[model samples]
Target: MKAAVANTFDSILKIEDIAKPKIEPHQILVKIHACGVCHTDLHACHGDWPVKPTLPLIPGHEGVGEVVEVGSAVTHIKNGDRVGIPWLYSACGHCEYCLSGRESLCLSQENAGYSVNGGYAEYCAAHADYVVKVPEGLNYVDAAPLFCAGVTTYKALKVSEAKPGDWVAIFGIGGLGHLAVQYAIAMGLRVVAVDTGNAKRELAMSLGAEYYLDFKTDDIVADIISKTSGVHASVCTAVSKVGFRQSYDVVRRGGKCVLVGLPPEDMPLPIFNTVLNGVSVVGSIVGTRKDLEECLEFVARGKVKAIIEEKKLEDINEIFADMEKGEITGRIVVSI
Candidate 1:
């Protein structure tokens, strides 16, 4: 099997011929057709987070393809079923968090592309119980990003608790934020897209966002407040400290702020303002298995679609470079 392997942190991923992964009794083998490149992949390759990924890693969590073989113990999933190997690889099913439907918080959880090898190769092994069935109508390239960027943003909006017709602001109209705008529209919420540059503004408006604010040229906080008297909820998908602060500041009284982006800095909250306004701050990670199913259904029904750029697997390094420079728009799916 051919794979892009990261042998060390802050080093370029090299394409190398490696031995194919053999499945365990509880695992299945997926012949990866397409895999979405995420910013987190760059972080994983660079060892950016406190909980570092294992060395000699194949970093990709949005891998989708056909099941070539099934484990002996796996019954529900069979060969030829199209499925996606997502971020939440596997979790201890009996844990408190898993029992309560918050499986992403399970203390004993394995993450694809982080704790273990993921779908960044010609063939990848996945836990049968954790892989999600890709909708029959969704394309492999399109369905790939839905496994991560799509599900993550949709789960963030769900946690925000903003009702239909309520105002919701999406910070950073990039890979995650672009999908967030479409999801908000489909869910009947008015969307305020916050980001700089005319290109992002046009993209947001095209996705049905009600308002587009350029953080670089416009007073986003003031503009949102003046129009909607503060949004009912703010979903911050930006990787900047200022974006996080503005996300918190633009929420209406009693509204919530959902943080999704993994910025490398602590977000400071105003204690007095939070108490007085009864505002809530939340940190939402990747989605659970159920969340992935629900979010994918939206795509299958034509309610949501990921704006993706397709590239070959050999272009992985250039993709990472573009991600670090913030030059890529939407999501990039590598055709394996």
Candidate 2:
């Protein structure tokens, strides 16, 4: 099997021939056809987070492909079925969180591309219980990003608890935020798209954002408050601390601010104001398997679509460079 292996955190990923993964009785072997290159993959390669991925890792979780073989214990899925391996690789099913439908918070959870080997290879051994079935009409390249970027944003929006016709602001119009904008609209919430560049501004508005606020130019906090009396909720998908602060500031009293982007810096809150205003600040990680199914259904019904640029597996290094430079406008999916 061919894979792009990150031999060290300091160097670029190298394309190398590696032994294929062997599956357990509860797992299935998938022939990866396409994988989305997420920002988390770059963080994994550079060991940016406190919890570093083990070195010599194959980093990719938004891998969508066909099941080539099924293990003896796997019954629901079989050969030739298309499925996607998302971030939540597996979790202890008996944990309190898992039993209550909060499986992503399970203490004993194992994340794909982080705690274990993931896609970015020709083949992957996935737990049969976790991999989601891709709908019949969706393209592999298109369905690839829905595994991560799509599900993450949709779950964040659900956590925000913003009702239909309520004003909801989406911070950052990049890979995740772009999809967030579409999902917000589909869920009946009005959108206020926040970002810097004019290109993103256009993208957001074209996707049905009621207003597009440039964080660099417009006074986001004042402008949103003046026009809409503060948003009912704010979903921050930006990687900057300033974006987090602005996301909090633009929310209405008694509204929630859902944090999805994982910035390394700490965001300090005003305890007095937070308590007095009854505002909620919550951190939402990747979605559960059920969330993945619902979000993909949105795509299958033609309600949401990711703007992706396809690249070959060999161009993984260049894609990381572009990601670091903030040069790419949307999600990038690698064809395996």
Residue 299, candidate 2: alpha-carbon lDDT: 97
The predictions' CA RMSDs to the true structure, in order, are: 0.7, 0.8
Residue 230 alpha-carbon offset, candidate 1, angstroms:
0.9
Each model's lDDT comes to: 0.95, 0.94
User: Can you write out model 1's per-residue Cα lDDT over 92-193, one digit (the tens) per residue?
Assistant: 999899999999999999998889998899999999999999998898999999999999999999999999999999999999999999999999999999
> How well does model 2 score by local distance difference test?
0.94
- Residue-level lDDT of model 2, residues 237-295, one tens digit each, is 99889999999998989999999998879999999989999999999998999999999
Q: Model 1: number of clashes?
A: 0
RMSD of 1: 0.7
The stretch of ten residues in a row with the least summed lDDT in candidate 2 is: 108-117
Please list the residue runs of candidate 2 whose C-alpha ends up more than 4 Å from where it truly belongs after superposition: none
lDDT of 1 at 213: 95
Against the correct fold, how does model 1 do in TM-score? 0.99
Candidate 2 vs. true structure, TM-score: 0.99
